[model samples]
Structures are given as structure tokens and as C-alpha cells.
Target chain A: MNKLSRVLGVVRNQLATYVPRINATTQAAVAPTADPKVPAPAKDKHEGLMEFFDVKENWTTNEVRVGRSWRKEELRIKSNQDLHKLWYVLLKERNMLLTMQHEMNEKWEPFQSPERIDKVHESMVNLEEVVRERNRAYYLLETGETGERPGRVETNKVGMHYFFKASEHVVPPEHNNHWFKKFGCNRREVAKFRLYYNEKIWLGRLKEKNRNTRHVMKLYKRFPDLDEEALQAEYPDVNLERVKRWNGAQGHFMPRNL
Target chain B: MSTRWYPIYQRGNPQLRVFLPNFWMKLVRPEHKQPENIVRFITPTQMSDHDIKQYLEKIYKVEVASVKSKIKEGLIKRQRFRGYIIKEPDYREAMITLPPGQTFKFPDISTEKEKRDDDEIKKFQDAASQSFDKFKEMNKDRPGVPGWFSV
Candidate 1:
């Protein structure tokens, strides 16, 4: 009983300090109340087609101020139900912006805050990413495999590897002659191409290696006092000792190492 | 599942559900006069008649009795200076019929715009007159001299 009371005392102290700190933070963040003379914005009363426009008062205004997009961290804390409702809100907002933009384009009037579209798009993207994360976690807990569609790297007709996302097909792969004819290339031609392609890549790499070796030798010949350890670190593939022994490494100045 | 993905519809499989639909529909003024009950919309090219009906009915809570959509091919015009053909993006327009009692009309937004522009012009004129008065006062000391000479 005594130990329980002691633990409660610590929690009580934490609550007392933490609650006041949170209150202070909120108070500091909130703006001061508007003057009594200034009228508060009227609630949105528009419906249907009218919803596609900004409020009547804002029609002629040169600038319209809006808040920033919802951050991913802020959205992740919301419940799935709240996120679902927010999705509809964002969708409607996007549609309204698009409609307003279209009308403005027709009339040659400047649309206020064009970034509003981007903000809504960003919020929607973040919401989707958060939902995807939750879905992945839930699926991982329930099923071993990710709920996402299965895909694999496969060679295309152009002989390039591409990720092929598997989808449900009425006809199985073996039975689908159209799929085989479209994606399959001539075996002999593909083999020859692959061999030549690999040789080209290998030659390019060999050239680069030789270039680095020659560059390192040149550097040593010009700057005898150059930091050999630093040069070795910079080009790990080059044999520094072998380069130092090369005749081209000799310079007019006596070697600094000697 | 996302709205972007669609699995092949098998006869016995349960109906697919779109949890996050990202399609956008914009209400546009009709190029030609439309009936009071008819509303025009520009939707994503991929939207079908059924999709348009469901989108409005479900998302906007607007009753859509019917939906007819047609793709307007973008205009291709050759640039006079650059000698290149420029094509506008193709768009699909949908005409939706509302319930019997409902009617919609596009509001005129430019009526108040002219009044606002007049106010702005008046303000600019006032500033210009005030600056001209200041210039006159500055030149009063040296009569018949050009304004640029004093500056």
C-alpha cells in the first residue's frame, strides 16, 4: 500500500507539471481574439454548383490566405475513421479548387492561391502513405505476406529487365500464346546480344580502371610529397605500390619518400 | 485497395471497393445554354458514365439521375512564330441531370469585379495627383525650368 502511494505521488507530480506546460504551449500558439467590431466569417451556406466557387466576399479579393497542408505526422495520430472523413473533405476541396481554376481560366481572371491545389494534393498523398503504412502493419500482423500485389523482374522483348506486377488473368500464362509472342524474343539473337552487351560493359569498366591507375601515377610523378595514404583511400581499386614502381612515376625532383 | 488498382472481375468474386478515390471533377459553365436541370462538368478522362454518376451522388451528395460524357479532342494549331503544332490536352465533359425539382445556374462573378477595379483606379489616380501636386510645389521655386533639371 505504501509503495503504491509513492508511485501515485510521482504520477501526480508529473501530471501537475505536464498539464500546465501543455496549457501554456497551447495558449502561446493561439492568436489573440479578434476585435469585437470585426465580424466573424459567416458559415458556408453554398450548395451544389455554388460550392464550386469561393465565397462571394472573396471573389474580388487580390489575395486569399490559407493554412499549410496537413503533415504526415499530424495525420498519423488520427483514427482511421477520422482519416476516412478527412479524405472526403480533401476530395471535395480539390474538386472545388479545380472548378474555380477552370472558371478563372475561361474568364481570364487570376485564380487566388493556385498553390491550394498542390497543398490538397500533398495532404492526400500523405494521407495515402499513412494509410498504406497502417495497412502494411495490419497485414504483417495477420498475414505473413504483404497485401500488395506480387511482382517480379522479368526480361522484356527489348531484352531489358522490368518489374512485372502480376495481375489476375482469365487465361493462364502457359495457355496465353499472345503473351508469349509479345514478350518472348528469339533465343539465339538474345544470347548473342547478351554476350556482346556484357563484353561492352566489361571493357568500359576495364578502361575506367586503367584510367584511374594512370591518373594516380601522374599525380605521384607531379607531387612526390603527395599523401600516398590519402591517394590509396581515394582510389581503392588502384595498386598504389605498383604505380609507384612504374618508370612514369619518376620526376626531375628527388623523390620525397627517399 | 487503392482506386488505381483493379483486379479482373471474376463471376463469383465479391465486388471491388475503392477506399481512396483520387478522381477530380470540375463544374464548368456550359458552352451552349443547357437546361436548368442539367449541370455540366469536366472530369478526368478515365471516368465513365457510371463513375461520373456515382462520384457526384456519393461524394458531393448531389443526386445524379443520368450522366452523359464525351471526349473533346484537344485543338492542334501551328504556332506562327515557332512553326510547331501545339495541342491542348484532351478533356472529357459530362452532362448530369438532376432530380425533377432541382435547377442550377452559373453565377456571374465579374459584376462586383468592375466595381473593385474602379476603386483601385480611383486610388491610383489619387496617388498620382498627390505626387503631381508635390512636383508642382517643388518647381514653384524655379519657374519655367524643366522638372528633370531640378531632380
Candidate 2:
């Protein structure tokens, strides 16, 4: 509690220093604060809606300069509540950028500093990763399970495997008409497809090996003084001595010793 | 960090709350005229009307009267020279009705200052062109000579 209060006090002091200096004209346009002595109850919640758009000053500028995303180390020290609040802050920032980008697209003007969206997205991702780490740790300590959604790898009709995240349905899968209708295909078709896919992959590898062997022979034939160790390192799968013995290794020019 | 994963929802269990909802929403200009209190938005196709309502009310603290949404098909057109058809991704648009006595106007962002900035650039270019012409005129009489050869 003491630490929480200290943190809150620091935040309040920062806001107290920041808010009053807001441009007088913009302040008049915004809702009036209740008391000058204490912070004005965080302004009305409804006014938070406007935060989904860039500030007026930024709307006119061709470029908006911003700092880099929050690093994982910086977020790790913050309390969960602070992280939650910051998530909303970044959420608002993302929405604002999206809104501006859409508007600019409609007007056919380039959106300024498009990477700002990526920075906000990176910070949010890092913040979520940190929260998930904490959540996993707590769950494991208390219940011996990671508090994440259960999922399983399953093959689709197209013979591709994907992670199927399990979720509840009002009707169980056995009775669910749509689930049963869309579930699988004939087993023979899958087996055939898998065989053909494996065959193609094997052929591709064989062709690549032959190509590399030919290339190595050409390299030796063209440059008789070339280092053998580097050539072996490059094509470890192909035997350099075998390549050198190949008929292609005999060049039109006279041998290096002659 | 796995964004697509969500826990099963059961009748008796606590509601599955999204602590870090990664879905995004953008306020967009309405295609047609809307009421003073109505604002249009473009959101991910997977978002439902309830999700939009909850997102605005809980996250933004805006009082929403109702939300209606529809998915619009993106245009598919042929490239002029290449003759290949290019298709745009489909988008979902939500119409949010705010409670009475609220109004939102999409602010005009760039036009006012753009003209002034363009004029300033044009003036600078003109001055630069005049100075370059003067320099070239001075060098015209002595062909194939270095610039520092003369004063």
C-alpha cells in the first residue's frame, strides 16, 4: 500500500505540473474543471472519446515525431495496474493513428510517420507478453497450469496442419451439425496427397544437390588455383574430390602445372 | 501473445474478459449523410456489434445508443497497362449512434496551411533559379573553362 501510494503521488505531482499549462484556448473548448486546488477528477470520462483522434496541433503537421516503443525491461518493473492503464493509452494512440490514416487515404494524402503505429503495436505486444509471463508464473505456482487457452494441432481437409484453439459451444461437437458437416475428407485422398507432396519435396532436393555438384565442378575448372577448403565448406554435402574427378572439371585452357 | 486464442465460455463460469484486446477501430467519414449524433467507424471483420459497443463504452467511456454493422465488399478492378485484376480486402463498417445531445464533425486537416506552404516553396525555387541563371550567363563567354578561372 505504501508503494502504491508513493507511485500515485508521483503520478499526481506530474499531472499537476502538466495540466494547468495546457493552451488556454483549447482548455476553454474542453469541459471546465471543478476545483483549481485538486486535480479535476480526471476530466469527464466522456471526453476520453476525443482521444481516439490526433490532437489538433498534430492534425496540421506534415510529420509527427515520436519516441521509440516501450522496452520489455521498462515494462517489467511497472505494476499490473499501471500496465493495464498504459495498454489503454496505447490502444487510444493506435486508434488515433488508424483514424488519421484512414482519413488521409480518403483525402489521397500520405499519412505522416506511418511507423508510429508499428511502435505502438510493438509496445502493446511487449506489454501483453510481460502480463502473460506474470499470469503464467502465478498460475503455475498456485495451480500447476499455465492459464492459457488449450489448443491442439489438427489436420484440415486441405492436408495442412493448424493449431485449433478449443472453445465451448452451446451444442457439443457430436451434435453440432455444422461441425460434423465440415470436419474431414476421405482418408484415401489425404494419403495420396501426402505421398505426392513428399515425392515432390524429395525430387526438389535431388535436383538441388545435382545443381550444386555441377556448380562446384565448374568453379574448380574455371579457377585451378582456387582454395579447395573454401569450396568444401560451401558445399559440405558434395564431395569436392568427387567433383574434381568429374569430366566437367577438365577446362579448355591448359592445366595449371603446364 | 497468441492473439487468436480465447478461453471457452460457459454459463456458470466468470465471463471471459479480454485484458489486452488487440482489435482496432478507426473513425471514418460516413458515405452518406448521418444524424448529428451518429458516427461511422471501420473495424476488423471479425468484430461483432456487441464487441463494438463494449469496446467504445468500456474502453473509451463513450455512451453509445446503439450500433449497427455491415461488411462491404472491396472493389476488384483490372490494372490499366498490365490487364491483371487486383482485388481489395473486404472491410466491416459500424454505425454508432451516440446518446442525444452529442455531435461529432470530422475536422478538415490539411487544406488551409497547404496552400501557404506551397507558395513559400515556389518563391524559394524561383529565387534559386534566378541566381543559377546569373551564374550561367557569367560563364557563357568563356566556354570549356573552370568556374574559378574568372572572378
Candidate 3:
């Protein structure tokens, strides 16, 4: 057992040496050191509680200028661990901004540059999307599945289809009596309701089609030399030739054919 | 749990880890006077006492002795202009107690702001008086002439 443990340790050390140090390079690239010629700004002491508020100078300022949010492409190049660290940094910043805004609201003062909240939120959303993309790609490559929460299109009692997100359950469908009883639907009633619902939808579509045809006819009547190809392209669903045959489509002066 | 979804916990299963926890907690001033060691926070309603404790201890690196939390119901009132009922969003309030000897005092920022405002007002008044004096000096040559007539 001792010999086996020693060999395993040797293997671990070898593997560690073989792995490239990606984190160090990424960190250096992310935050470059300030130039030696230019004096660095004074660093604030870590006042644990006061971290919730903005700097004292900005407390009274009317506007605080800040750069735009982190774009998706910029975040896409970052490693997972770097992204994780960034997420916390952004989260802390968001909390601080929120705290400042809340205090300002209470004191009847305008919160300077409220768009900063939106910027942080946008960065967070982009970061999450990038992480999800990576996770999806990894899952697809390894498991041959999307790895997202499984969901299915299910018809409700009202006969309307909705996406039902599947949740983990210890009990199987056959054993879950309570769920089956609660979700049971009346087939006959649903069928009758569905007929009316479908007809209503169809009627709405028909009205929209008629409105488009009438609109096209008005256009033809207004512009005698209207570009027929452009009009056809604009309203692909509407039959322009049939609408042109209508009397309302004729111009006041003279027919173009004559 | 706030932003990212986690798998359900089952017996004998591996522990669920949250890679991206989106829970946010904002430090708020206590409405009533509280002990120096206690800090107030406004958090999402979904956050529990344990979550608040873990959040402060793990993320903020603050030593927490105990945590107490309560959900404040939103106020429902009639809109003055529209005469419609509107409800404010409900939020969870957390009171975190630090270990002995650790104390935090809320900073007073309003006094500094008031001083700056006073300076601003004085500057504006001085500028206004100077502009008025110049206008009067220009109009002294021609009496009873409108200011816009010269321009």
C-alpha cells in the first residue's frame, strides 16, 4: 500500500507539471500593472462595511462617468475560473450600487448615473449566457444531450399547449396518484372548447388577410405607377394580382394599360 | 437559487454546488437604533437566515455570530393621479450580529453633501448678481429700453 501511494503521488506531480499554467497568463492579461512613470492613485483601506457605499468624492457628485458593460466576445475568451471570480466582483459592485441608490432614494437625492446598474446587469447576463454556451457545448460533446432542464409540450385541461418543465421526482408517474388526479382533464369538454378556440383563431387570421388585401388595393389606387414587384415583396401573403383586378384599385386619371 | 437553477437534493446523492450564485444583499441603514455589532441588510424574499449567514461569512469574509431575517410585506396604496391601486415590491430584511468586539457605524454622507450644496448655491447667487450688475451697467446709458432690444 505504501509503494502504491508513493507511485500515485509521483504520477500526480508529473501530471501537474505537464498541465500548462493558463490562470497566470489570463490574470496578467486581464489586469495589467500600472505604468511606472505615472503615480498610482491612492488605494482605499478595506473598510468592510463602507464597501457598500461609493467613494466619498462621488457621494455628492451629480454624475459619475463609467465605461460600457463587458461585451460577450470579451467574456467568451475568459477561462471558467476567471469568469467565476469576475462574477463575484460584478455581484459585489451591483450590491454596492444598489445600496447607494437605496440610500439616495431615502434621502431624496438623485442617484448619479443610474444606468450603471443596467450596465452591471447587462454584463452579468452576457456572462451567464457565455457560461451556458460553454456548458451546452461541453455537455453536447460528452453526453450527446443538451444538458438543459428537460421540458415537454403538454396539453392542459383548457386544451392549450404549454411547455412543462420536468422536475425530479422520487415517485414514478404510475405511483404518483395525487399528481394524476389533479392534472386529469375532461376530454369531451376540452374537445368542444378547442373547436370554438380554433374557429376564433381562424377568424382572426381571416380578418388580418382581408385587412392586408384592402391596404394593398388602396396603395394601388393611390400610386398608379407603384412598383408592383416591391409591393408584392412587401406583402408576400397577399395576392397582388387579384387585388389589382378590383375596381377600387383603379386610379383617378387613366389606366396605365391604355 | 435566485438566478441559476440547481438539481433537487436526494438521499445518497452528491452535494449540489452553486457555481454562479446570483443572490444579492444590499447593506441598508437600520430604521431604529440597533447595537453596534449588528448590521442591517435588504435581501431578496427567497433568502433564508442560513443563506444570509453563509453569504456574509463566505462572500464578505465577515465573521457572523447569528442572523435574523424577516419578510416585509409591500405597501398597497392608491395612485394619486391615476386612482389605481399600486403595490410596492416586498423585500427580506436581515440583521447580522458580528462576533464580540467587531462594530460598524453607518457613515454620515448627508452633511458633506449639504455643505457642497451650500457652496454651489453661494456660487450660483454670486454669478447671478454679477450678470445683473453687468446688464444694469449696459442699460444705464439708455433708460427704459428692453434687454432684448440691443441684441
Local distance difference test values of all predictions, in order: 0.76, 0.76, 0.77
- Among incorrect, acceptable, medium and high, the docking class of model 3 is acceptable
The model with the greater DockQ, 2 or 3, is 2
Expressed as tens digits, the lDDT of each residue in A22-46 for candidate 2 is: 2222344456666788675433223
Per-residue CA lDDT of model 1 for A1-258, tens digit only, reads 133234434533643311001112222324554798866432222254565666666678766677677778877877887677667767777887788788888888888788888888888998898998888788888997667777999887757789998888899978999998876679889888988998999999999999999999899888877887898899999998899889998788864569
**Model 1 residue A236 lDDT score:** 91
Candidate 2: the clashing residue pairs are none
TM-score of 3: 0.75
TM-scores, each model vs. reference: 0.74, 0.75, 0.75
Flag regions of model 1 displaced more than 4 Å: A1-46, A210-225, A228-236, A239-258, B2-6, B32-38, B72-89, B98-102, B131-151
Candidate 3 C-alpha lDDT tens digits along B68-97: 899999889999999999999999999988
Candidate 3 chain B — worst ten consecutive residues by lDDT sum? B1-10
Cα RMSD for predicted model 1: 11.0
Q: Tell me which residue pairs clash in candidate 1.
A: none
- The candidate maximizing lDDT is 3
Best by DockQ: 2
In order, the interface RMSDs are 3.8, 4.3, 4.0
Clashing pairs in 3: none
DockQ metric for all predictions: 0.29, 0.36, 0.29
For candidate 2, what is the DockQ? Answer: 0.36
